[model samples]
Target: MTTPTSCAYCQQRATQLCAGCRSVVYCSREHQKEHWKRGHKRECKCYEVTSNELLGRHLRATRDIRMGEQIMCEAPLVVGPKVAATPLCLGCHRNLLAPQKPAMTFYKCSSCSWPMCSKECEKSPFHLDECRLMAASNFQSKINYNPADPEGKESAYCVIMLLRCMQLKRSNPEAFARLAALEDHLKERIETPLYQVLRANLITFIKTVLGQRDWPELEILRIAAILDTNAFEVRQNGERRKVRAIFPGGAMIAHDCVPNLRHRFDDNMRIIFLAKRPIPKGAILSISYTQPLRSTVQRRVHLKQVKCFDCACERCSDPTELGTFAGAHLCGKCKVGKVISQNPLENAANWHCQLCNVKKSAREVLTQDARLQQEIESLDKTTPVHLEEFIQGHRIDLHDTNTHILQAKYALTQLYGTAPGYAMDELSEESLKRKVDLCEELLQISNLFDGGWSIFRGNLLIDLEEALVAQALRLQLASECESKLKRAEELLEEIKNIMKHEPEEMQQMLAERQQILNAAMAPFSVGVE
Candidate 1:
């Protein structure tokens, strides 16, 4: 009366067995076949090992993993609050749907209608939580959630409360219950900080400058202002119209000098992480949590100043960490080699490359970077319509692989594909091809840095496939067109393998791709070649 084995596919306990592969058991033949077809055909055997637990875990490579293999799929554990902060679709967070007519705006939520494709999207699960909160407020509770602000900033108050909510959800239900109980009154203290110093200054400013009116938009600006003025360190890149103010949650993720993860956001405001490299089992996964090229001393100081934590990560401990004296060059005059401070925890001492007598303070470097960043920001606003000029200007200061340059390239990719006046459709064939070429170039860099089963890579593949298909359609050469069509098909298949769990969307994309391939190959069907 032994218990039956479990089905490998869904991990369900079953009495029935597979007829074809009697070695494996299943609840039904259909599941057995499905499992085999899904590439579980070879991993059906059971084995015994005599090694220690770590050896048993590490030594066994049950199957070979391809570079871009689909390892696992998981829905988000938690999504951000759906308050209207940005011009993104509430459902997917990709940019909002464009209006069909030139003059008319798209549909918005009846309640807040801040930014949405339609009322249908307003009911989406992603919008449910924030919408509920917003509804409870009678639409009066402005969470400082305007995502369309040119500064692309969020209210520190709102962000801090969100973080507090997340922490409470994990630690104390009673405390969470108390906060939830006060949900109605929560809007009143939207200007107050959880910390005392911030709270005192913020209240003073609210009384002095803003008066008593509950201007939600004004409140949001004030929060951003507090972050800009009082937050230990602020980094702003005006060219990008983006500011990265350190958040407690983002800070808690910790740091790794050679980080395995990179992150980006879509229009819907989702934080997506991609694997930069093959992370082996038992590896403590990490993200940089700061700019990668910053010297160890600079990174540590910035983290401690803003995050309120001392980082003793391996890279921070190394004297010549990140290989550039933390990007501080040697002082030729003194010839005494300067290094990142031995005590990174204490914000003592100006940067004096120990070897050279020359010294520069942390304030000096930060001030310079901030000033250059402002110049880049100013240039960014002017050049959105003139991309080539934008690229040329950014190239002068930021290296090709610098983060600023990569950010510029990403913008260029989007503009080339979708920017109305300066899009691929308006460009000549040569220019269109060049745009596609640049996208492909960046895609390669993205793969190198953010490749592991991530939404970023997946979306890039989709974009690349679309561009190739477009190129094939434009070309008159039957043979060249056929080759491009085949390449696109291969890329789509790779995408499917990586995104198989997303069957509904993947199936639709696959069918559309097949249709394009068939259309492209039709002219060559009756060819003599």
Candidate 2:
């Protein structure tokens, strides 16, 4: 990569190439501005794509990155449904509005039978290529609104994304090149059951049914694999809608269990990454590929299955799981000691108890853990009764910070203030104490695993502050209430900083919380003024 010596507009010794089109060289800032105004706006990408030994290809620092800095902002290269169970607009990816009468039907694309929100979306450039292909194939979609099991109505629109990626080869070859460049882990995925199903069904459809057999079978499969390896799942703060999109740059940043970065989406659906903690120059930038609350074992298994690697980060290698002990179980034989994995990184490692020297097979531990998780999933989270019952049942087997119990506690935090029988004011003193305890416990855990102004810690703080404020109102002592309120204020300030990169909805929530705190304090002040 030699630097260009001539300007793109006029032949002169170049000082800068057009950042958007690195191909175009400019000798002066004035020439750069002229080129940008003329046409470079069409291709002004913020980040450069590069390759390395560790990540294959990953986004890297061009300069020193500060704390709370915005690194990459990217729009979706291709967006479509994600394993949808019901009819949703192929354009907007929202659940199709069920008809008022049983005889009525969902809105459909005028060109293709696939669902669409309106005629405008039907005409949208994003949907047109696939729409034309499906319409030409005479493959009418049977997926429609099923009010009986609205969210469970299985759809055949899964192929739409694959088709969109295939269409890009014709529509934009450059983007197709980028998509093709992504690491697909095809060697690993080929043995998986999903690839087998695709081989039998998708291959026939793309080659025979759609009559596009000219495309190489491996290339088609490679595109599908690239999507699986690189795409992001995107949704708004409160929306039920979820769609898949690829941000080439965002896709390149590698994963760390305790990541330095956190990501959020704007209303337009662009992915934005912000530094959760101050990242030093030359340090690898990463984000968590798994949920923050998941135990090391669970995260490792998921990463192995999906990303095709075992995570051996600081959190995963530790037997105590960074002191959270989220994967630890009670030693059934010892009756007093706790059990943990002998090798946290290995799937087949034996479990051992510190006391009594009791040992258990990995199979035995995993099976029991699975059974407990299934039991927890069967319960209704909106009510605490079932969760509490499950907790009580597992009292002997699970420690307080065991993944299952911690999951129950997290669910309880959401249910306490908002559940029908347990609104904030209606909560008994004992229940309020429990909610406070859960939030505090998780906050400490967050410090260990999701530290330094991460969303996980910020959310826990929010829950804890609310619980403290509610408790303060019931306390007779003025000093106690004031002291608790002051802590809540401090937490609120931290929340503001943690959520600076968030969408407008979070800002609104913060404002509402501040008002709530202010109103709560008005009763305490009996000023002379």
lDDT against the true structure, per candidate, is 0.49, 0.81
Q: How many backbone clashes can be found in candidate 2?
A: 1
**Residues forming the 10-long window of minimal summed lDDT in candidate 2:** 95-104
TM-score each candidate: 0.49, 0.88
**Model 1 per-residue lDDT tens digits across residues 43-123:** 442111123331111112122223333222222223332222334444434344223322134456666544555677778
Candidate 1 structure, TM-score to reference: 0.49
Q: What is the lDDT of residue 215 in candidate 2?
A: 89
Question: Which candidate has the top score in lDDT?
Answer: 2
lDDT tens per residue, model 2, 1-529:
4657898667887868665335567888888888778777665543455676656666555444567877778788888777444566777676564333332366788877777778877887878898888788887777666557645756476688899999998899999887877788888898789988887888888889888879888888888788888889887635546778888878889888999888988877899888777776556778999988888888999998888877877888899987778998888887888889999989899999978789999999889888888888889888888898888998998988888998888898888888998999999999999999989888887777788878888888888888888998888998998888888888888889988777778889899989999997887677826
The TM-score of predicted model 2 comes to 0.88
Each candidate: how many clashes?
Answer: 20, 1
The per-residue C-alpha lDDT of model 2 at residue 422 equals: 94
Mark the regions of model 1 whose C-alpha exceeds 4 Å error after superposition: 1-194, 197-277, 287-364, 380-387, 394-397, 498-514, 524-529
